[model samples]
Target: MYVRHVAAAAAAFLGWALVLSGGPATTATAAASGESTTAAAATGRDPVRLVGAPVLYAHRGASAYAPENTLAAVDLAEDLGIDWVENDVQRTKDGELVVIHDDTLARTTDVETRYPDRKPWRVADFTAAEIAGLDAGSWFTPQFAGARVPTLRQYLDRVRFNQQKLLLEIKKPELYPGIEQDTLRVLEEAGWLGEQQVENRLVVQSFSVDCVRTVHSLRPDLITAFLGTPAAEDLALYAEFTDRINPWHTTITAEWVAAVHALRGVHGEPLEVDTWIVDDPAVARKVQAMGVDGIITNAPDVVREAVGGF
Candidate 1:
C-alpha cells in the first residue's frame, strides 16, 4: 500500500514541477522574498537538499532565544535569517490544533496560576479560548509576557507569512486519538495540503510509528519524517512511508547515515537523515561532519556559523 502511494505522489510532484518549471525559492532567498521554501522536485527525485549545507531548522523556533512554540520564537528565528522552523502540535479540548511542546501547560505557560485548581493542566483539558488566555512566554522572560499559545492555524499562517518552511511534529498522537486526521484537516484548511506545499514547504512527522504511517496513508503527497532512528533492519520498511529518518545527534554515525541514504523514500528518492536538538556549536559540527543532512537546533545562527562551507 505504501509503495503504491508513491506513484500518486510522483505524479502530483511532477505535475507541479512541470507547471512551475523550477523549484520554489531557496530557503535563504525565501527568507528575504516571502516565498515558499520548498525546492522543486525533478522527475524522480525528492524535493530536498537546498544549497549543499545541511538545512538548519530552528528547533521549536529558536527556543534558546525566545519562548518555544510561541509566535515570538518563530519571529526571532526569521530575524536571525533561518528559513526553516520546527514546531510541535497538540489538540485542545475544543479539538483546535495548537502549537506547543509539552502535553501540559505549566512548563511553558502560567496555567497553574491562572486556573489554580486545574492541577495537571494538560493541554487537552482546556478549551482553545482558555489556552489562548494563558501567557506562554513569560516563563522564558518577562519581555515576552503576553505571547499566547498559538493555535495551529495561527502558527501555520505565521510561518507562511514569514515565508518559512515547516517540520511539524504531531506530538503524542495516541493521547488525542484521530489527531492525524485532525492535523491533516487543519493543514488542508491552511492550504498546506496542496501539492506544492507538500512537495516543497511542508513535512509532517511524529515519534509515533502509527501516527507517521497514518499521515502517509492519508496523504502521501506530504513529505513525512519519523522522529527516532529505527532499527537498521527496519529502515527499508520506514522508507516506504517516511521521507526522512530523524534521530537524536548522539545516536548516529557516518555508517548509519549511509545506510539510511542508501534506501529510497516513498517519493522514489533516497531517504534523508536530519538529527535533532543539537544546541552546542561543537556538537553541531560533530553531526555535520557525520554527514547528517540537517541539524535541528535552538540556535540556528550559532550552528550555521559553526558549520563552515556554506
Candidate 2:
C-alpha cells in the first residue's frame, strides 16, 4: 500500500514538473535544478563521518549551554563545531509559528505573573507579539534577560545565514490545527521550500504520525523523522511514512536498530534509525557501534570528542 502511494505521488510530481516545462530548454533547466537540489539536500553538514559512527545532532541547540529552543542555543551549537541543530516548533493563537518546546509558557517565561487571569495559558493561545513580550530567557540565567521567543522565519534565517543543518520538531499538532500548513508556509516564505535545493538540509520531525504524514504529502522531498518510544509495533508503523526513526536512546537496542532498517518505506527505501539525549561518551560510543545513523544530544562537544576518538 505504501509503495503504491509513493508511486502515485511520484507520478503526480512528474506530471506537475512536465506541465511547468513548456520547452526543451526549460525542461532541461528544471531537470538540472532538481538534480542539484537533491545532491545538496542529501549531504548533511555534520562533521562526524557516518562511516564508523552516527552523526551528532545538537538536541535543542545544545540545551546544556543555553536556554533550549532559543536562537542563542542554536548559535552556540554552530559555534561549538556541531554540524546539525535540533529545535521545536509550536503555533501561536494568531497562526504565527514560533520556536518552543512546551505547550504552556509557565516554565520558560514570566507569563504566569504578568497575566494572572489567563487560564490554560498555552503558547497556542497567545499571539506572536504577546509571546515575544514575555521574557523567555531569564528563567535560565539572568544574563540572558530580554530573550524573546523567536518565530520560525527568524530561526530559519539564522540557520541559513550560518549555513547549518536543522532537525525541526513540530510539537502538538492536535492542539494547534493546520500546523502542517503553517509550517510549510513559513518554510516557503523563507525561501527554504519550493524548487530550491536546501530541502535536504532541513528534517521535519513530529511525534504525531498524522502531522508527519501531512508534511510528507505536501513535500515528498523533505526528510521526515518520526519520534517515538522504542516499540516494535510503533517502529513498524513509522516505517510506512518516515525516512528516519528517532526513538528514546534508553529504549534503543541493536535489535531495534536492525528492525527499523529492515522495514522499508512507501518509497521502498530503508528507514534510517537514530536515538536522542545520548550525553555520556561511553554510551555514545556504544550506540555508534549499534549502527544508528545519528545521535541527538544536549552535549555535542562531548559526542564530537567521542566520535573523534573512534
Candidate 3:
C-alpha cells in the first residue's frame, strides 16, 4: 500500500513537474544536476549522524501514550529517553506559531461545542488565546481533561529544558504566508540556534520544498530535511538544500536510501535518509537493516528496544 502511494504520488508530481517545465528533462534542472555523490555527503557531518545510525525520533511526542502534540505527549516522550522528539507547527490567526497536527481543530479539540458559530474550526481562524482555551487533551482520553495546544515557544522550552533534540515540521506551510520566516524568527529568539547547535540538536523539515528552501536560505548553518520523494532532478536540488530526505517508511527501498545518501547537501554534507511512522518492531528492524539513518515513530520505546536487542 505504501509503495503504491509513493509511486502514485511520484507519478503525479512528475506529471506536475513536466507540466510546469513544458518538458521533464528541461524544467527540473535540480533533478538532472549531478552524476554522483559529493565528498561532503560521504563525510556525514550532519545532526542526524551525530546520534548515530538508526536514530530514534519521538513522533508528536510519545503520541502512542498521550494526546498527540500536547504538552503531556512531549513530557512522556522526553521521559522515555528518546534521542529526539518531533512536532508539527502551524500559525494561528494572530500569527503565533502553535503546535498541532491537523489544520482543523475538530478532531483534537472540542471546537464543535465550544464554538459552534465558528464552523469548520480551522487552526488559522482562531487567535492563539482562543486556541489556548480549547481542550486539546480530553478528546484522546478522560485522563487529560484540559491539555491546551502549546505555542512554539512553549514546545521548544520543554525540548531544551530536557536537553533533547527536535525534528520540527512546518505543517502545510502554504496555508500560512510568511510562516517560513516566522518560524525561523521564533527559533532564533528562543536561542535554539545559540552557539550554532543546529548540527547538534535542531532539524527544520517540511513537506513543501519551498518551506524547506525558505528555512535553508534563512539559516544556512541549520540542518533541514524534505519530507517527500522528489524526482531525480528535484532530489538533486533537495541535496543542495537539506541535510536529510525523510520519506514514508512503507515504500522505502535500499536503493532509494542509497541514492539519496549518494547526493551532497547545501553545506557539502551527506544527506541522510530517514523513514517515518513505523511502529512495529519487526518492521523497524527491517528498515534499520536496510540502512535507514533514522526512524521517526510514535512508539520510540518499541524501536529503541528493538535497536538494543540488535
Best-to-worst TM-score order: 1, 3, 2
Q: What tens-digit string does per-residue lDDT give for candidate 3 at 165-215?
A: 888999999999999899988998898987555868898899998998899
Top of the candidates by TM-score: 1
Error of 3 at 276 (Å): 0.5
**Any idea how many clashes model 1 has?**
2
TM-score of 1: 0.83
Model 1: per-residue Cα lDDT at residue 255: 73
Better of 1 and 3 by TM-score: 1
What is residue 128's positional error in candidate 3, in angstroms? 0.7
Model 2 TM-score relative to the real fold: 0.80
The order by descending lDDT is 1, 3, 2
Candidates 2 and 3: which is better by TM-score? 3
